[model samples]
Target: MELSQEEILARLAAISQGTAVEAMKITITEAFKDRVVATMPIEDQHRQIVGYLHGGVSVLLAETVASVASVLNIDIDRQLAFGLEINANHVRPKKDGVVRAIATPLHLGRTTHVWDIKIVDEQERLICVSRCTVAVVEKPAS
Candidate 1:
């Protein structure tokens, strides 16, 4: 069964309270089969020395949304999802403004999944584009 949106948001909230996500101030806004969305506010901690939002922070947001969406598609009792590869292209730079990331599946397979993530500033200008590949593995024996 697919996870409810509330459950997904709760999971994201829990994750954001953890190490890196908390530092980046990421909050998941929406999640479902077709799309997963998150937002991160621009803060001093999220900026590069020159004041632009850090590229790695964009990639982190992309990977987080893509990975969560892929994991949501799997049957947790039998399989687990792990990110295999990811690539990001930073398009525009922003010094201040919240950024939102939207992730959509390019492919959803039995053993692998591919997702495309787009990060945009509050004005909707593209900031980064990312792709993530996830591998579905059988659950390990406890």
Candidate 2:
């Protein structure tokens, strides 16, 4: 049977425990086979020395959404998805408030998935744009 959206979101939340996604306070707001969305607040931990949003945090959020979206597309019982590579361009500086990230698949292949993720601030202005590649492989025996 197919899982409901709430079930999927709950599973995603459970899977994020103790990970960077949890530590960074990134919340997955939407999840689907074709898309995923998440949000993070720009707190002190998310800022660089000059108090601007850290580039690495943005990349992390981008990759997190992409990887989660890939998991949603694959059979978790038999497959595992991991980020292979990601590139991001930080466009605007954000000091405070939440940043929303929207991720959509560019390519969903047998072994890999590519996602385009856009991070926008409260005003919906672009803060970062990223493309992430995730590798889907058979789950290893426990």
Candidate 3:
């Protein structure tokens, strides 16, 4: 069954309420057509052995932000997108700073979605970038 626009919006709001991604304190700063923005403060727990922010954290941010956008763009009833392919490139290292990730829909098709994800620091320097492909699948009956 295809979801109404209001249903989709309600689902998004419900997911935002207790999202596991929220554990990272990833705040949605802005959202618009085909795009969404999320921000996080990099702390020691997110750092690597060398005191630089963990590379995995960057990847996680990219995936989370991209997933959020793709989810909102798709049919919200039974269909859902699962990560198919994701590639990340880290440009700079940081230990303590505010990091923001912006995800934009590159392509949204019936079976798949592609997103371009970018992360920037407090100084507005690009810290990480990624391209993600999510496979749209049917949600199982409850």
| C-alpha lDDT of all candidate models, in order | 0.88, 0.95, 0.82
Task: Please tell me which predicted candidate would have the highest TM-score against the true structure.
Answer: 2
- What candidate 3 gets wrong by more than 4 Å, as runs, is 1-19
Clashing pairs in 1: none
RMSD of 2: 0.8
| Cα-based TM-score, every candidate | 0.91, 0.97, 0.85
- Poorest lDDT segment (10 consecutive residues) of candidate 1: 11-20
Best candidate, lDDT: 2
lDDT of 2 by residue, 1-142 (tens): 9889899889989989999999999999999998899999999999999999999999999999999999888988999999999999999999999999999999999999999999999889999999999999999888
lDDT of 3 at 96: 90
**Cα lDDT of model 1 by residue, 15-132, tens digit:** 6685777778888888887798999999998899999998988888898898778877888788988889999999898999899999999999999999999999887899999999
Q: Of 1 and 2, which scores higher on TM-score? A: 2
Between candidates 1 and 3, which one is better according to TM-score? 1
Model 1 off-target regions past 4 Å?
A: 1-3
Alpha-carbon RMSD, each predicted model: 1.6, 0.8, 3.5
